[model samples]
Target: MTGSPWYRDGRMRYGVGIEDTFIPQERIGHRKLDEYELTQHYARWEADLELVAESGAEFLRWGIPWYLVEPAPGRFDWSWTDRVAAKMQELGLRCIVDLMHYGTPLWLENSFLNAGYPERVAAYGRAVAERYRHVWTDFTPLNEPVVNAEWCGLTGSWPPYLVGDDGFVTVMMQLARGMVRTQQEIAAANPAAVFVHVDAGFRYEGETSPVPRAFLDERRFVGLDLITGRVQTSSVLGEWLASHGVTAAELQWFRDNAVKPDVIGVNYYPGFTTARIEDGVMTPVRSDAAGLRDLVELYSARYGGVLAITETSLVGTPEEKIAWLRDSTAELTALRDEGHDIVGYTWFPFFTLVDWLYRYDQKQPDEWFREFGLVDLVRGADQGLERVRNSAFPAFRELAIRDR
Candidate 1:
């Protein structure tokens, strides 16, 4: 807290996730599998890492499909992560591996949401953290506890989707518990493993339906509170949590245990803004993008931890994206100046993703597929990579090199 970043910061570091930048998700249901397309996808990812390395960013966040790593119990093949991990090192950029992005590796049957899923995931996390002890240093054990719980558990939109405030608490508990223990297990083995806890950022109640807003606003974070070990006799949130799936006993466990994060990696997405409830539905309230900075500050205050925007992107022209980036950076700079331990910043995806709005329900290429990329997918191939020397690129460069 005395110095800048608390850990790492040179001109307020800049980085982004390599999702839309590289790689593609394998189809879940009856999606056709042409081996040729899949192989091509992997090859493109290798080149994409090279792009990430050359982007003048300090780090690149990538992930491995859990299904591939642990096909079943006791079986581990790291080929899925090996290529990316090795490539990241070869490029001389740090790797922040995303262990859990969406759900379980499918073979786990979405196990992290299960009762004992934490035990299983922790087992794997330890083995994995140890195995990659030499190369991968950072780990995002799970992504977006509140969002994942709501989407997968409350809405029943995702796999193993269940609907209820209680179900939300249970699933979120399994993830937070499993992820923390996994990091601990790794620390036990390697003694050098450090975890950067990643959380999604946004403040959205519902629009029309009282059902969504009711629980989302109040009961959404029972597990997060528990894992952070913040349960107390006088906690207003704690008592309400007890009435839901999270009970007094669970609160005790979280308060007594739960290792606080080394760096709380926040995935600051605009999508966290208002949804479901709209003008005529629930209320017309909407959280402005500028207000997002306030939310980040609030989280840092609530928990004595370092903060970083691990993800952010928008569907707009390159210039518009730059404006968004500039504004967000200014906000981050203010937060940093305000004495918050803000050490890292990211633009997210560096490229646009396909079918995300579809929820994997449809494979159609919507208008969004056009170009949300910092460097268009064809930047390297078509325009000698100079194609990307856009307005936003220089702002980041000026920042990284500025004498602040």
Candidate 2:
């Protein structure tokens, strides 16, 4: 998977995300999962992925938990990563490695409130990049900064559980800096590498952007600019930032130091979007997953880069999910016909995830996040856990191959 030649048009290129690839056994150590339990879990994940690769996906995007990577701030693990990378290479798939997918090493305690966290993360990042450079091609420094920052830092909604807005700004800026730095190191080692500034595809129902309220767009593109170094301290907007204690010097520094993502990844999901929240269920209002093709064109125009929908799922109800996927694929084809840089389309995870973070049993019970996957997590006494592949699997397989 490392150092493979990929190209777009005449240049080397490919599209597709690595699916159902996070490991429970590796990051937290074998403590969370037993060897006896993983036999089917690992196999199913690999099988579904191979199926996606067969659909003409050039590379897969997956992450390693920081908590799992470095048990201590400086210490690291390479064994689990090596095995996964090798498997990907065996399957003839290149990989886009995501360093921290919103969470940090448990030792860091998910400390978004601290300014120093990102710096330490960068040090660890440099090491991880050097190690994985041998196995992966591209890299994503942080995934979904807007929501991640909000959940982990600003709103005090997630782990490390801090309250107040002060931490949010600090954490986001640090991440912006960290991502730029991570890409720099990775680029230095592998001069040909590209960085994907990956963003969650959902919009907040507030201020400026797409959501009904003006606040929706208010924070919509916030993540992109932060990573690209667009936020500054001296402007009118800087005043608002100052309310949270962002200083002029730091803001200017970030603006001057912004690092642009080589490819901007738009990761989509079904859970966050809504029609009218009818009866508290987020019905599909405007969705490519529903054959309502405009969103594809909207995104293509919004971000002028080789575009790919990183993760799109029709969460809940196997039948609905299947129908949504079929619609999404067909709509993607339409976008391609319209000459959108529609590099490639993807329906992700290929398998089920470790129960979604967004949908906890106690929290957001109505959202149904776990059902977005293409497989059902079922364990058999003899087989361990198996991915009872959904009906959409065969349909997607058939479509993906037709073009691949």
Residue range 66-168, candidate 2, lDDT tens digits: 6666888688877767777778888877677777676665566446545567677677767766776766767777877876767656666455545555666
The residue-by-residue lDDT of candidate 1 on 102-129, one tens digit each, is 6565556545455667877778777778
Off by over 4 Å in 1: 1-11, 20-41, 205-223, 271-289, 359-362, 365-370, 378-398, 401-404
Using TM-score as the measure, the top candidate is 1
Note the Cα lDDT for every prediction shown: 0.64, 0.59
Question: How many residue pairs clash (N, CA or C atoms closer than 3 angstroms) in each of the candidate models, in the order given?
Answer: 7, 22
- In model 2, what lDDT does residue 253 have? 75
TM-score of each: 0.83, 0.79
lDDT value for candidate 2?
A: 0.59
The 10-residue segment of model 1 with minimum total lDDT is 30-39
